[model samples]
Target: MRLMLLIRLIFLLLLNGVVLSYAHAASLAYEFSRVSNNSTEDLGRQLSMLVTEQSGGALFTFSNRLGVPSSITDIYFDDASQPLFSSIAYHSDSGAGVSFDSQAAPANLPGGNVIGFLAGFSGDSSAQSVEGGVATKGVMKNGVNSTDEWVSFLGLWANAGSFDGLIKAFADAHFRVGLHVQAIGLAGRSDSYVNQPSPVPLPAAAWLFASALFGFIVIANRRKV
Candidate 1:
């Protein structure tokens, strides 16, 4: 009985640790999709992404897909999201991203084919990065009845504070940006993109794995009894 009790305690602790890890994860984890299909650029393999915080700003990364090698990236955005909230932050893993060129404006802006920046992210810990950024607010067309915004950062100058400072820097730049150009892609593909929520399943897998383990342990415990 005591052994079972101790096992339960450890199991609970392990589950709690996993939950806490995600709760305070410094990485800006999210699922995103195109806000609209009205893109002028052709979309390729959806670039898997990660965003996180640095000393005064945030960082990002692009990959071929989850669990696969990191891929090069070039498109980003300063979405018109209000408050620039980030419960998490992350950087890229293998290859960092950069701007191929700078000529297009964001979607909500006066001139541009899309609503994204020409910037990309590096590995979460890379020293290579772009500086300065832009943020849009409730300007992206999210279909017939919705609107949205985005935040793109190279190296935002913060007020010398912590994570909150990062958020503030973006909030401070809630204006239309000029000359970001469009993200590079195929000759006939659209480079500009908008954002909508994505329904990824990776994050939930942790709990599923834990439950499986718990079931296995219970079975073994009953067998021993």
Candidate 2:
């Protein structure tokens, strides 16, 4: 009887470990943001609308200034949304235009998901000279200025067997992904934002299977005793 109890304990430990491993294996996380106001609501609504339309899921705001240290606020999405890997755009203090860091996606993320990003431009008419683009080092166009920007967009690209394989693809190539919105400036301001990785809930079927497995293990132990 004692031996049977020990066996059951070991089985339970192993099962818990498997669930934890799967949780770590099936998800990815990243940071994203853009410039916007704190006093207004239009920009917030616009940004939320754009991200939802582009990503085909819900857009949860995070922060206004993730890349920019002096930024007022930056935004992030909920875990349910796939995230794109990249670096923050650097718009200089002197306004020599925007400079993007040499950014690359990590070689391995937990989930086998792909993502794309797009930004709409709107803001102070004077600061309108602020522009952005993807390049080796910096923003290419000066006329690309806008208050609102699409810092990152997420979408499923392709599936892989392992997390490491998915990461490798993100690191190596730029896959053409689609955006949900075409506009640049959101109407209002958002100060607070959400940035935590989304949790993957176990499906009901999986839960039932696990329960059955546990019951079988229990019965097996009883017979052995």
Candidate 3:
């Protein structure tokens, strides 16, 4: 009977460790690069928007200061190198100087709405063409490792011709670009964090708890004998 009780205690302790590990794994955290507002250097050729820490899931604002045509082309979530969503923006021949074709399908986001809006040239006028908009989604949580996540923006300027044209235009002076990004949510983590070499470290408390339980079991078994 004492042996059976010992086995049960060990099982319970192991289960508790697993639960704690899972809680740590799912504790959402995030990090992001500061938006480099470069419009001054490029004479409206560059600009930036921000998704600040205070706004949990609010839409930020963006602008195109360069007299030349420009628009946001893509948005990346979690991984800056890999865009989860994208869009197309261009000046219409006749109507609003700028229009957007958002590829934001909510299915891509884990939760919440993908919100967007237009302003300036896209909203009011196109003469100076000083208009743009921002969009965002999901309740960014706070944590690190599996918990960390973020969003990034990709904008383009004076792009014409085919998609190939845009690539070529990237090399030209008239073609400008900008970026705006922020890490929303909480939990502490470094921006450059990568997976640690595994055999995950066991928390010291787990070891202590297991040792205490084992001692208690030994005492109980002696008493039983």
Candidate 4:
């Protein structure tokens, strides 16, 4: 029994190492911060309407909270809508040692969503480009393995530009996305977060009713306390 317990504890520790990297990495618990729009292509006539559709999912960024101090390896995102990506056109106080990796399909993600993996952040990452629904993935050029908490990557959606957005329209998974931080530092722990779109604004009457209901609940809770 003692031996088995020891083994189990060790296994848990290993699991923690793997998952915690993501946990601490929840981009520092913010999941993704909304960044500005990227320069969309000019397709003349957008072959797909997803470029401007609300359900198509908007552009967001995955950044590190503690990554500046520690090492970072890659960034992963899961979406059933077949997300699109563009090249790195902007950089400010971002991770220096990293470069975008090829967009990969999700091996373990659920909901038939695809996974995009940008690897080699600690070394001279290769060039990155997006083709066939993936981004630029090249070989290491001369990465300095720079690290910082401000390290961030684009979710790469909402890329509608003068080119009429994109040649194709992507049907995102109802405006929901799973942002994942993976394999950072020595432990290689990871964490996954599912982002739900904000609720539509309620009417004034509905808001008033909700406020009254909230007041009643708060009073009741106070009494109980």
Candidate 5:
């Protein structure tokens, strides 16, 4: 009887641990989409709606990271306007040099193109620009632009911040911005051209796992007694 109780206890612990780990591994992912020929207001509305739906009616933050001032102000549309709200004062990523050039073809801002920028728009002016087709700015650290040479824009988006601010700015500037969201990360850095996702804790699954584990521990203790 003692041996059976011990085995069950161990099995319960293991199961609890497995469930918790699975919950932790399940990160928050944003459903991203590209917007086309739409005003920044329109984009904001869509994003706000998406956040409400995804976060279950919670007020979430939004931002934008444009490599160029004009990209934030211009490009999203033909009209010049202001954003709904000023960008929040957040630290820019140091380490690598990042920039944006709208005149560059193929990379020129448009309705359907997606781009990624380094986390934290803060950095040196001299670092090599992520523009010109070399995407994926690798782990930005210490004000140096040490991004990998091979990654492309799409790859950068995989780890970029959501450009919620830029989208708002564009709309305020009277330009229509349309974007199709692909995915949202719980945590990540943002820049002028790209919006990285951040890492966040798991949802209700985590709580459920914890409750199960607690119940298991109590039952196991009673059996041992």
Candidate 6:
């Protein structure tokens, strides 16, 4: 009976540890999609996307379907008017065909493009990555060109002090962004509906509680034995 009690106690401790680990670690995560399917003309030949609240952690990977030389110029978290982050050259990933001359074929941005400058949480610049998916055609009538680009940034973590208030502000809030032509003019405008931050599962804690109760029962039984 004593051995059983000890075994039960150990199991409960281990289970609680797992819950704590998950709660502590931040996984940079986010899901995104185009804002609308309106024709390119109706949308003004611009690129825009909505970043939903299905995002967590500090590392953010932002991708845009804008044409070449068109890049993410600003990021607005929640309702603030001024951009939370901005940069002219966010730097493209290898999949963006960094070497390819856009003027030659007027190719679209690579779907696997990644912007590295947005990473703020993880000090490791290399943590940003690009997943090169198939290049989808852009909102052009020609339908011959592909306009997509991506970049990863160590978001929030690195700039927490400057963005401390915004960590939770984005949850249930909208993220509006602007894409600009490298030369001049606005390329596109897009926004996403960010859901409220989902709470961590309580099942882990519930299991821990039950385990503790079981341990108590085991101890009580051993005393009687």
Q: lDDT for every model? A: 0.36, 0.30, 0.29, 0.32, 0.31, 0.34
Estimate the TM-score of every prediction: 0.42, 0.27, 0.22, 0.30, 0.28, 0.32
For residues 1-225, what per-residue lDDT tens digits would candidate 1 score against the true structure? 778877976787687778655543445444334333334432333443344555555554333332212222223344333323332223212222322222222323222334443222211112233424432122111101111112233444323435454334433543112211122333222222232333234554577567766876797687678
lDDT of 5 at 156: 14
Candidate order, TM-score descending: 1, 6, 4, 5, 2, 3
Tell me each candidate's RMSD, in Å, in order: 11.5, 16.2, 18.2, 20.3, 14.6, 12.6
Looking at model 1, which ten-residue stretch has the lowest summed lDDT?
Answer: 139-148
| lDDT by residue for model 6 (1-225), tens | 768867877886777677655543332233333333322222223333222222322334444344433333232232233334432122233253221111112121211123211211111112122326534322221111124544443333223323333444444333322222222224442222222332233344567667777877877777887
lDDT tens readout by residue for model 5, 100-146: 22222223334333332112111122223454466434223212121
Overall local distance difference test of candidate 2: 0.30
Candidate 4 per-residue lDDT, tens place, 25-67, comes to: 2212222321111212111111100112123322233334433
Q: After superposition, how far is residue 159 of candidate 1 from its true place, in Å?
A: 1.9
User: Which 10-residue window in model 6 sums to the lowest lDDT?
Assistant: 116-125
Off by over 4 Å in 6: 1-25, 39-57, 63-150, 156-167, 174-225
> Which model scores highest in lDDT?
1
Question: Model 2: residues >4 Å from true position, as ranges?
Answer: 28-187, 190-225
Query: What is the C-alpha lDDT profile of model 3 across 132-177, one tens digit per residue?
Result: 3433222111100011121232333222223333323323312222
TM-score top scorer: 1
lDDT of 4: 0.32
TM-score pick, better of 5 and 6? 6
Candidate 4 TM-score, true structure as reference = 0.30
Predicted candidate 3, C-alpha RMSD? 18.2
Residue 49 accuracy (lDDT) in model 5: 13
